[model samples]
Target: MTTVVKHATIYTGTEKIEDGYLRFDQQIQAVGPMADYHPLVSDDQVFDLAGQTIVPGFIDVHSHGGYGFDAMDGNADEIDQMVQKMTANEGVTSYFATTMTQSHENIAHAMVGIKKAATKNPVIQGIHLEGPFVSPLFKGAQPEKYIEGPDLKAFEHWNELAGGMIKLVTYAPENANCAAFERYCLAHGIVLSVGHSNATRAQMKQSLATHVTHLYNAQRELKHREPGVTGHALLEDNIYTEIIADSFHVYADMIKLAYQLKGADKMELVTDSMRAKGMPEGVSELGGQKVIVQDQQARLENGHLAGSVLQFPNAFRNIIKFTGCSIADAVKMASGNQAREFNLTQKGTLEVGKDADLNVLDSELNLVQTFSFGRSFNPENN
Candidate 1:
C-alpha cells in the first residue's frame, strides 16, 4: 500500500513545491505540486500535513553515539537503542556509527557489534572509522596511545570483522603509506576523510581525501604564512567539509565564512555528537576518556574539546540561523551533500524511486515527526 502526505511545503533537495504531495512505500513513488497528486488506490495511507513542511531526512555521517550509549561499547543492543533514540529525538533517519581511536581488540569488537546491529537496523548505514590512523598531536578526544600511521592491513582486518561495512575513514594526510590506503579505500567504496591532523595545506593538497572531518577542529589551523589543513579545506573546490554547527563547536561567523566559500553543496552539517547528546548535562565517556558535558559543550578533563552533544535538528536550524541560507540550501548540507558524497544512491532527496526518509516540521521549522522508510515517528512522543 502507498502512503501519501499532502498539503505540505516540500523541499525536494533539488526543488521546492509549495503545497506539494508525496507518495511512497519504503521508496518514494511520486512527488509533485498538489495539482499533480492523484490517488492510485483507495487504501493509501493519506496524511494531511497542512501548515507543515517536509524535507529529506537528515543524515549524520560523523556521530559517535547519543542517548547514553556510545558506539564503542561494542554492544549490539545498546547500539540499536542508541540509533532508535537518535531517530526519535533528532529526526536522524540515517546515521553512521562513528568509532573512536582505540586498541586493536576494542576497535575490532566495535566493528563486529556495529555489523550485527546493522543487520536488524537499516538506520545504521555504515561505519565511520574516526581513528587509530590519526595524528597524535591533534588527537582531541581520541587516545594518543592507539593512534598510528595509515596501515592498510590493519584496516582490512577490521573491515573484514565489520563484514565490509566500513564506509568512511578519518586519517591524517601526513601519515605514511597513505597513498596505498587511499587507493584501497577508493577502490572498495570507502570514503577517505582528512581529520585530526597537523598536515599543512600542501600536504592536504597532496592527499586524495575528498572529505574533511569537523573542519577547523582537531586539525591544523589557517595561518598567515602557511595555509594549514583548515585553509586547504576552504580552498579546495571538490572537498566536502563537515562542520559541527552547534554554536559552541563553531562560532556563527566562522560558519558563515565557510558557507560563503564552500556554499551549501560542498559543506555538510554533521552532529559529531557523542553519547552525552539527548541526555542532561553531566559526565560522559568518549573513547575511554571521561568527559564533562556542560554549557552545551563536551570536553575532556584537560580542557580539550571532546565530541559534541548537538542534536541534528538543532544543527539544521543553526545552519540557517548562522548562514542565512534558505531551507533548500540547508537541506543540501543536512542530507543532500552527504548522500551525494557517500553514494547513498537511494537517499537525500524527495523524488520518484528515492527512499521515503523525510522529516515533517512545523511552521517554525521544529521537527514534528519523521518518516523513515515509510514508518512514522513523532518527536514529542519520544
Candidate 2:
C-alpha cells in the first residue's frame, strides 16, 4: 500500500532527479534520492511534492478526438467520453483512437465503437486507422469522398470488426494495396504509418514502413533532388517521426527541425487532436468536415489544416519551448518515444518497475497532478 511521492523534480525518461523520491502501488516500487526514501509503514501514502515536476504519463499515439468528442463518435458512450476527456483534461495516460476518412460503414462503425470503448477505457490505447487508405494528394483533413485504394481484403474486414483493435495505419506507401498493405501490416503486428503521401523516395523506401505520419503536415515535401516521402521523413535514421507540437501544427522552427532530425529516441509527441479538442472556438467536426477552431487552428472551411486543438499540457510545453530540449528531452518526446513505438512495455518511463503512469508538472510544463494506472488525477478537480 505504498504511494510515497516526495519532493519531486523527476523526469526519468533518461535522467534528472533533484530531491526526488517516488514509490507507487500498482507498480514502480522505488525511485531515487529523497535521501533514499524511508517511511515504509505507518499508513504509507505520503506525497510531499513541494517542488513538483515529475513526468511520464502523456502518450498520445495520434489522437482524433477530444472534449467535443469524436473518435468518430459512433459512441461507446462517446468513446467513454473521450476517455474521461483524455484522462481528466489531457494529461492523457495513454490514447490513440484516431479514425478518420470514414465510410466502410463509417470505418467499421468507428472500429466497432473503438473496440467497445477499449474494453471500458483503460484510456483507450489502441485503434488509429486515419484513412480510407490515404493520399488524395496529401489528404490533410482526410475526406475526398472518403478516399480509398489500399485493401488487404478491406484491411482484413476492418481487422475483423476491430477485435484486433487495429494498432495503427495511415497508408499511401504507393497504395494500390501497396504490396497487400505491406503484407497486412507485417502479418498483423500493425502500425504502418507513412501518411497521406505522394510517396517516392523509392515509394517510401519500398514500403518497409518505418513510420511517419504527422512529420511535415500531410507528408511529401523535403525536395532537393526529389527527396520525397518528406525525404524519408527527414533523412531516415530508421524513421519514427510523428511530432505535432501544435503551434499551428509544427512551427517553432519546424519543431526545431524535428527535434534536430528525430532525436528524443526518434521523436513521437502526437496530438492530432480533433473534436476541436476541449472545445470552445467557434464550430467543430472532424472527418465529417465542417470544422473551424479559429485562433488555435483546426480549419477546413475550405482552408484545410483541421486536426489539432492540441493538449497534453500544450504538447508538453511545446516540446520544451521548441526544442531547447531537456525536461528529459520533453519526456522523451512526450512519453518515451510513444512507449517505444507502441510495444508499450508498461507504458513509457519513470524508473523502478513501471505502470504507475505519471504526470505532475510545474516548472512551467503546467499539468499539476495526474497519475493514471495508480489512479489519482486532478486537472483542477476534473
Q: Best lDDT goes to which candidate?
A: 1
lDDT (CA) for every model shown? Answer: 0.91, 0.81
Model 1 per-residue lDDT tens digits across residues 35-98: 9987775536899999999999999999999889989989999999899888877888889999
TM-score of each: 0.98, 0.37
Candidate 2 minimal-lDDT segment of 10 residues: 36-45
Q: Give residue 45's lDDT in candidate 2 (0 to 100).
A: 77
| Candidate 2: C-alpha RMSD after superposition | 17.5
The backbone clash count of each candidate, in order, is 0, 0
Candidate 2 clash pair list: none
The number of clashing residue pairs in model 2 is: 0
In candidate 2, stretches whose alpha carbon ends up further than 4 angstroms from where it belongs are 3-15, 18-20, 25-32, 40-93, 98-102, 106-108, 125-129, 136-194, 199-221, 225-240, 243-266, 269-331, 334-355, 358-372, 375-382
Which digits, one per residue and each the tens of the lDDT, describe model 2 over residues 264-365?
788888888887777789888877679888888888888988888888788878787877887787788888888888788888898777888898887677
